[model samples]
Target chain A: MEGNLNALTVVFTEFYYWITVVVMFLIHVGFCMYEVGVSRRRNHMHTLMKNTMVIPLVTVTFYLFGWWIYFGFQGGPGITGGIGDAPFAEPWSALMATHLSGPSPDLGVSGDEAALWSRLNGVFWAAFLLFSWTTASIVSGAVIERIRSGAFWMLAVVIGSFAWIIDAAWGWSSQGWMVKLLGYHDAYASGVVHGIAGGFALGVLIVLGPRLGKFRADGTPRDIPPHNRWLVTIGLFLIYTGFWGFYAACNIPIISPEGIAGQITGETWTATNIYLAPTTLSAITFNFIMSLSGGMMAAYVVSKGDAFWTYSGGLAGIISASAGNDLYHPIQALIIAAVVVVVIYKLHYWVERRFKIDDAVGAVAVHGYAGSLGVIIAGFMLWGQPSSPYEGFATINPLGNFLGAVIMFGLLGFLPGYICARILNAFGILRIPRKVELEGLDFEGDETYNASVAEVIAAEKAMV
Target chain B: MSTNGLTSWAVDLKDVGAIYPFQGTETVLVIILLVFWIGWHVLQTRAETREFEHDLAADKSGDEQRKAIDRY
Candidate 1:
């Protein structure tokens, strides 16, 4: 009977993650379409391809090392302890490949670990890989027309596989040093993924320089609107759909107190966040809709029904309240989302005018600034609450989350991006040549497409 | 003679684990996959650079640019 129950639990958990991976694929689709809508017709193909390729580029590299880093570096490699053992996540571990969950001492994983992790490994890896792709794609939309695809792909790999995973290990993991020491908590990666990626895009943009003709001699900014307004709104809607899956993937579907090994005193089975703290899908569901409503309402009033900002406000709202959605009252999530969205919108324009940083789609404000603020707000809202069920862990606090936001957006996000962009610029491989930018990134491809269309039309005319 | 080492289904399910062929070759498979992944990026970058150079050479006339803008 015990064997049957264990098998049932494992299978159910496996299926749960598989479903989440399928839903998360829409986030990539939405990102690709949104970028294409934002870019000009002349640069459409390049914009689409740049975002599309992040899927494969990040996936392969994440498989190579990113998964291992999450479990391996939880101790900060020195903060809490030495590099931890994560045999199941090793690229060459048999558990990472096809397995029936049977004993195989030849594999790096022990028999016990294999029994638990083998079925869950692939789906778990894929779910995190989708998040990595999201982080990389956030940077893609900000540097559309002028950046080289090769340089961008390289940057994507660094963020998707290296930088974001390191932050996750530090803050998102149950045993992460940040959670253990400072009581850092971001249930849905408001800072770990969005904040870091947003900051990284800002760093790259500063060094890559704004799009040509983006600023005038007087230093006032011009509004470069999306070519397909409808497409942009539709893409935002699709992103909202995928974000639902993202929230689900952040949980352990079902586990008992015995499994958690923490301070909770009950035999009850429950879902938990990545930090092994109690939460429920029902609580987050209520929070997601209310927060989204608050953001859209605030943005409609602020932007005066501007389609792009209004839709983006919905996303920024969700991101802003994401950190504490796991625990906040629905009304708290709504107010937080409303306040953060308004601030991010105002800050977006202020930064653009103040610094002449031409962010094509407000990625920095929506993701970086909003995400960082969300982490800080979660700290204050949940202050003195237990960060984890584990004994002796720090309780959630304002100071810890604020420092966490800085580390995510500055240390891990902006620093690497700035250094990388500077190096790529020095090597003269960062941006497209000026003539190429003016003529458009897809000049030759467009010409070919044009010639083919004319020939097809002429042939059809003859048939008439 | 079965490829998966599974000739019968009468055995207890608890004894089953890895049923795939080449079970012990995970290390070699990973090395091969790693090389392919890196090699793809190298080849792809070269192709992309050449394509960009071609686009720069072919677009001296701004006719295509005007048509694209007008279409928009």
Candidate 2:
């Protein structure tokens, strides 16, 4: 703690992110509810457990190495510069553990770095960790009712703690190569979080195959209505609410001119997007509501008033516009959202029927397709814009953004997902056995439940 | 040449304001958004009416209605 003003700023920043982490927790809660609601009664327990377990598994692994990857790989090792130094993020760093406001003997962290990290490290890590869990949970929803928990958990770690973090290093970070070279501008992580997760889901689905009975004899897709429409609606609403926190968390709540250390020449304190480019809460708020409204309206018309599609369309709308929401005119966001909803809704069914790949929810369309489209659109909408405040960065262009979208959805998102799923499948652990799947993944739990009920009934009758 | 008229963020933050793209089109954008907001309700009401009509026709026998009530 130096000056009183400086001290207050640090404390405020810390508390700001802490609150965002809390709000973002609702995103997971929403995902769990949404997945459980969509699954049949026989699959409820398994679905809930599958999504819920991503939290602990991804949390532990993220703490172990995920944070390090963000700072360590910012260079693309050579694209922007050499491998950046990020000792504090390393697992063995003393700063990684609880330490007082002083230098450490465990690692070579100086007093200043240690002081800053001592207060900020845990909260920052947590904010990003929530993102990690979200990425993994996105995949979780698409594979519900059929994927084994153990197998899914492994996939969760790959996306949550490894794959997504690597993309964050290359795309989302301020000095990330994509930001430097491609002018990739995903202010709310349309590509970084949703795009990658969506691609990862598609990768897994390609190999995991459709859930039994998802297709008819003519190879046509069937409508698998959610077991509980009320739960699904409520869950989607909660997700919408939690997304406010997600948006806030993507920003530097406050930063001074000196903090940015780039071309941004100013004494004014302000909020910056992930790439250290300026934006406002007011602008993003306008775009968020407008895009959401646009999405819901378009979805209603396109789906002919289907409840599930309407809600999912709203989410898709927000996601489709999220890449440029930081800078988009509110109306531009709305129209873009409307356009993407129609495209994604059509694509969702086309992909389902054409490939017979079952996505339990329209995750691939909502996250993957919308996310990719948002990124490409941002290239044109924000064309000639600086991706980062730093010098030598490429201006935002359609080609750059299109390439970034492909890398996010195809390279980082899908490739690893397919490879890992293939490995899991070879060992006969990817999908559950057909008999158990048909009976439900909760069959074992059901057996125990029945046994307990029979015993309780028998005991009560005897007493009577 | 940038979308918001600033090619770089090198300027002082104190001077910087309203970074959203298409800076002077707020009025037009507002009009468009207003139309969308109003149009949504119009479309939604019509869709809801259609849905109700379909529901009435399909469940004319009242068997499905009874089942729904019973399930509840």
Candidate 3:
């Protein structure tokens, strides 16, 4: 609407985010497939539905309050002041609907703000919404089979719409207190998305307990093999593809120095992390592939070429190195990923045995432990580096990021998750009864289907 | 003149901002949508609980449950 340069930038940025939202949809699809694949044949339909419902449920609730939480609570509310203004993200804003980017004085949006947000807001909100679905779906995998659909959906809304979004506000946002005070530097949400979701899943798993027969009378854990290996492999592959979109969504694709209005003073236009610090697509691409390769190779050797663990290790690799991927040398990313996978793989089994907790899909280790480690690793790797381009922000340090990781994985993630799951459990809704668990979640549906088939066959025989 | 406040397309496009119909009633629309969303969870939760309770009442025999496990 203004200069040609401005128009192009706005359109391109808007389209860029829109594309990422589309691609990130694959993450949810992958989750459904992966959960169903891991579940028994008897529980297949129920498992798939459990993950699939996360999409719609999280979407509406996210539209309601999640997006607003991201902008409004960046101050810690308690840290800087109180809940701040975020006119563009408010659910009732005119900009929240279809708009052409002109003046909206009656609606309290200025022409300048409207023009920018009009093109960007929907796509940005959608991209974050997809991340919300991913967060809830991550928990869905670890709690399949025994978790009541009703209870899981309620928990999904909590994490997808409330808990994870709050962590995003506190750590992932540019003006978050974790960044300004603690020098947190999770450029790609190793801690914000993956870490918190993982911890939340762990907390829930502790309360919900394992699937029936997940343990033996002797207290030894059993390895429940996936019902379908092909689906599991394909699901993991799709997640890898969607993760590219997640990484892209984490960046401000292109911005000029003045756009950032921070310490960065240059004529060069560049991509930046969520914190408005400069990075490049090239840097992340190199690290993403390298770390993934490192994770797979290490996991294959460590788990003795177990396909499930190998694929998960590759994901853990990307997540473990994601915090510093923007600045990491590819080899550094690879080495970090390789080492972290071994530790997490062992920790997964250790936690399983020691705590008698059964994680159906190892989500707690792959996402939670790997993600927290990544955030802490970034502080050391990028020590003394500016956490944000903004003046007066704290420099990146180990202590700051360690505390940030704790806030992400423990304070925000585990506490809310444990409390919510406990509430649901106390109400006798968290886990399905032992009778239902043994009979299969789809028992009634399967029985009805069998009866229908028999009746149709009898009718067909009479016609013949 | 229109629900979207557009009488014509004859004017400069730059003057147009919100093009959605019933723009001023966004707050009301949001309120209605919020109620619908929360209502959905309530209904869904009740339905699911009912299904589970019905399944529990139907009460498959021990042998049938064993057979179901074997299907896995």
* Ten residues in sequence with the least summed lDDT for candidate 1 chain A: A103-112
lDDT of each: 0.87, 0.90, 0.86
Report fnat in order of the candidates.
Answer: 0.00, 0.88, 0.00
Clashes of 3: 0
Clashing residue pair totals per candidate (backbone < 3 A): 2, 3, 0
Q: What stretches of model 1 exceed 4 Å from their correct place? A: A460-464, B1-72
Give candidate 3 regions above 4 Å deviation: B1-72
Q: What's the DockQ of model 1?
A: 0.01
- For residues A194-251, what per-residue lDDT tens digits would candidate 2 score against the true structure? 9999999999999999999999999998888999998998899888988999999888
Candidate 3 lDDT, B22-62, residue by residue in tens: 45655764565466446545755666687689778774677
Query: Compared with the true structure, what per-residue lDDT tens digits does model 1 show for residues A1-464?
Result: 13787888888999999999999999988998899999998899999999999999999999999999999999999999899899889998888899876765576666656777888999999999999999999999999999999999999999999999999999999899999999897998899999999999999999998998988889998888889988988898899899999999999998877778776664677788899877788878888887887787667667756888888989999899888888776666777887899999999999999999989989999999999999999988777767788888887889999999999999999999999999999999999999999999999999999999999999999999
Q: In terms of docking quality, how is candidate 1 classified? A: incorrect
Best-fitting candidate, scored by TM-score: 2
Per-candidate TM-scores read: 0.86, 0.96, 0.86
Which 10 consecutive residues of model 1 chain B have the lowest summed lDDT?
B3-12
